[model samples]
Target: MLKVVVTGPLAVGKTTFVSTVSEIKSRHTEERMTQAGALVDQLDGYRADGEAAKTHTTVGTDFGRLTLDERMVLYLFGSPGQQRFRVLWDDLVRGALGVLVLVDTSRLEAAFEVMDMVEAADVPYAVGVNRFPTSPVHSLGSVRAALDLSPGTPLISVDARDRDECLDALIAMTRHVLAPLESV
Candidate 1:
């Protein structure tokens, strides 16, 4: 079994992405946003990404399961997007196979922190761009350049609401994980 961590900034669709692709019943720990909490959690970054205001947010974590085949099963854990909830990251990242960091083009800078965390954890990862209807289109090269991604890292475009799209990203992630082993 492989454990894949789905992480990204607030409102980057981490919860939605996990929900769309998980084969088993998904468990999400979301809480309705209160005005007091909103004051502490700034929306500047997400709004910059052209996301509509979010009413609820994932406070703890989201859990789901995916079976690639009879021999391979992936347990998906989506960490809370908010920085305040990073207390759970240590627990969430244990024995993770890899990470899928979702990025919104409108706020490219927002991905740096998550990428850094993944790197610090020394985990292999793939980047998935969660495409929204209003998201600006950019060439793969430009997007990779903007994110400072290496040639080997997988960067796939997907719609969080679309199951096929999410599945395609998962396929890309699997290939990324296997490429080095296959070469050796």
Candidate 2:
């Protein structure tokens, strides 16, 4: 089994992305933690609307499975974004091939902590910019510069609700992870 971890800041659509591409119904262990309680987790500009009703902040992790081909099965694990849950990252990332770090253009700074953590872990990762209704459209180059990503890093736009787009992102990560093995 190939493990793929989807990590990002709070409310950046990590769960939604996994749910979109997962073949089996994804299991999300999510509970709403009060915004007032966690000063580090900000809910600014988060609208409480129709979709908001179903929104869940991942308490631990979201689990999902996808069969990419006859020979490979991907196990998707989504990490909780709150600072307090940072401890769970090591456990989630162990033995994982790569990570897909979701980002919201409007809240780019929110993604910094998670991105830094992934880099520190020495895990190869690609950035998936989740397109939200209110998210501003920006060039990938600009977003990469803002994120200070290296030229080799892959960055792509995706709709969290679209299954094909989510699958494409996962495939990109797979290719990134496999390139070195193929060269060897």
RMSD of each: 2.1, 1.9
**Residue ranges of candidate 2 with Cα displaced over 4 Å:** 35-38, 48-55
- Candidate 1 deviant stretches above 4 angstroms: 45-52
Q: Per-residue CA lDDT of candidate 1, range 70-184, in tens?
A: 9989999998877889889988999998889998887788889888888898888899998876668887789899989999999998888899998888888878988889988
lDDT of 2 by residue, 66-125 (tens): 986899888999998788899899989999999999998888998889998999999989
What TM-score would every model get versus the actual structure?
A: 0.92, 0.93
Clashing pairs in 1: none
TM-score between candidate 2 and the true structure: 0.93
TM-score (C-alpha) between model 1 and the true structure = 0.92
For residue 170, give model 2's deviation from the true position in Å.
Answer: 0.6
Which 10 successive residues of model 2 have the least lDDT summed?
47-56
Question: Per model, how many backbone clashes are there?
Answer: 0, 0
